[model samples]
Target: MTRTTAADVRRDITARYRARTAKSRARHAEALRYLPGGETRGATRISPYPTYMTAGEGAWLRDVDGNRYLDLLNNYTSLVHGHAPPGIVEQAADQLLRGTALGTVAPPQVSLARQIVERVPGIDMLRFTNSGTEATMMMMRAARAYSGRDIIVKIDGGYHGSHDFVEISVGAEAEAGLEPKARLESRGVPSSVLQSALVAPFNDLERMAALLEAHHERVAGIIVEPMPNTGGMIPPAPGYLAGLRELTDRYGVLLLFDEIVTLRLAPGGFQQIAGVLPDLTALGKIIGGGFPVGAFGGRREIMAQFDPAQHDQALFHSGTFNGNSITMVAGEEALRRLDAAAIARINGLGERLAAGINALFAALGIRAQCLGYGSLQQIQWTDAPVVNLGDARRAAQDTGDLHALLQAELLNRGVYSSNRGMFSVTTPLQESELDLALAALKGALQTLLPYMREVAPRLLR
Candidate 1:
């Protein structure tokens, strides 16, 4: 018998996916006439054409092909309550009729802001934006203005947003080692932007301190995801966050926590759970109640920079849809419903999902491990301790296309999630849905075993 290779598995998966998603393929072709790569967001793109989703209800998504799948990705973890929650829908509809966007701040906007400040620790005040990208950008700018520094320290492989300063070292090279010199991950980013960003290793306190110490004079802020979401959902190692807080304080540099995805992890986010607060916190995703929104806020002194009273020196900030009524009311409703109990329940489910997948991997004698903090998960094909982005980068390099193949297999089995092996549990997710996802995962693993044994036998050992 011929040894089955990963390429063979990929080819088979692609062929099957193409056959099943003919309509989506056609739609993608039609989309190519106007949109770049037939999609607006790069995350949704996948091999053999991305499935065009038609509708989503609760934790399920219906594709254009009329196939329904349990939505494990949950729109990149923006929908904590899943899709079309009754209260949010009603609130959004009401706000739409009243006005989606008003020139002045609306009642709903104030209400939502208050809710955020009350729940999320360290946010004395905040300003809304259209997306997380804008939130992070504004936070960094605020830090620069507050500290009068130009350089910003960021974790390697940490994704803040699409902004020029943050668009560096995101897909950092594993072989480059710790605190690799900032390299732009995308084209069109000027060299000045790259130079202004100092890349540091995640969870490694000593390395982080060294980077800050070396460049503390020029450093305005150290921006990080409290629990890294895009860089494989890696949690902070014990005192990692506390250490960051200490270093920032000692250096007089602001600390900005990007809680866009991890906000769903706790009632007050991972910062509350960890008990380490930053000077500024960037929030998005679930806060919008399944709509577009982002915010950054912190100490009153820092946030006051945006206060119009200080006209001459105030950081100039304005957006046409900054505090849009629809998202505001919907977000307030979403936050209102996401109580402590709901957070605990969803986080518990995420833990169970990670544990179940790890058990399956162990049973199959694989070197794979499911890593993440509460309510988020990522399947890393390495047993190594994944404390930082470099470790994650190594795992990604080692796994080759295993994750992609697994993702394709999962989709084929009627489950949808990130092809990069990330998944998040929604508030409305049932235990039965998790069970089904686990079953699909197990089947996916079994199907990939031959390829694993041939291409990278260490994974099966």
Candidate 2:
């Protein structure tokens, strides 16, 4: 493939996507009346309206319109074993026959907790929640209660969940009034909450140290995604996580690792890979085996804040659907199946896919790159090294034309990935699936090259 400019690629891809979207617009128009943005999640919405998936199995998903495509997105990397895996389905169905939510103790809950405790080294005791958002919220509450402090620190571009406290500064642009150190991105997130949340650039140990020093006594915790998933899967730099641990300890602040997405990176999640354990760990996604579940656990001394036995405990955490039998059964089975060997195998597939994509970009002379860690990968249309959210924001702006074209062309070619080019490899995906994806990617790139040539001549040069 010949080198092409970004603008020409954008124009060509947009033309094709507009035509395809025209046919789907009627359905989307009807959906918008009931569902905001014609989608269930904020991130899932994209131009041309997102394709509504009907069913999924193994490494493939079929849309409502009968379009079948390889399931590279993997339900945002939650379905590590792939959709409707036999073990997960069977366990869930068995538990469903018994009951859904008893609002009481169930055997499966204990079973799943044990599995998690056994797998994750840092977790001593665990509490269940309905979603990662809820788990992270509970983590913050626990951190505050344990430290008797109000403020929390988060990495820039890190996404813990949709909760107001942690959502600040995520996906915020520099022009959006985001300060280099900290800024609030959402309204109704009380000024108190905003004031309590501090942001530090990822991979910047010195800046983080400065923030910790400034906030010292008032900082309850330092919460971060061990690997930033929201801003295109940027891995933590060497010693970066260890540095955070040291700083948090120095300031007497709790260190919380939000591994909701990164849990799939290893059997013990990024903490194991980074070799730095946190005071608390937030978990979700693959742990639930495609079911809704969230959990937070750490040192028993700190986690006792949630114990009902503690009369004067300052923290309270409870949810009706938490520890629901169906979710517990599914999660238990999922974790049971997700051994170290399985994790390594899935990661191997991701490495292969990433290598192929990077090679394609080099061969085609496109200023694109793949970034991720273990089963998760994101395509960035910039040659710049992305270390922090600021870097991601810059990359997004500089390569907007190329990103628009790449997404449209990939969609048209029947390869579904997140709008930001996030893709995950499931256990069920074989080399053949990888080959198909690579071929589809090649075709899409070839089709958009003419447009790229017209748009950004300097990029191709």
Q: Least accurate stretch of 10 residues (summed lDDT) in model 1?
A: 172-181
Q: Which candidate comes out best when scored by TM-score?
A: 1
lDDT assessment of candidate 2: 0.81
TM-score per prediction, in order, is 0.97, 0.93
Report, for all candidates in order, the number of backbone clashes: 0, 9
Question: How far out, in Å, is residue 305 in model 1?
Answer: 0.9
Over 188-272, each residue of candidate 1 has an lDDT whose tens digit, in order, gives: 9888897688888788789888887888999999999988878578888889999999999998889899999888888789899
lDDT per residue as tens, model 2, 1-461: 85655555565677776665554667788898998888788777767566667788888887766677887888788888888998789989987888899979888899999988888878999999999999999988888888889888887777888888886878644443344655666777766677788887778888778877877889999898887888668888999999989988887889999999998888888999989989999998887878888999999989987776864744677788989998888888888888888889989999899999999989999887889887998886677787776777766764445654566677777777877788898888899889999999999877766765665444453
lDDT of each: 0.88, 0.81
What stretches of model 2 exceed 4 Å from their correct place? 1-24, 172-179, 454-458
Structural RMSD, model 2? 2.7
Q: lDDT of model 1 at residue 228?
A: 83
- Estimate candidate 1's alpha-carbon lDDT, on a 0 to 1 scale: 0.88
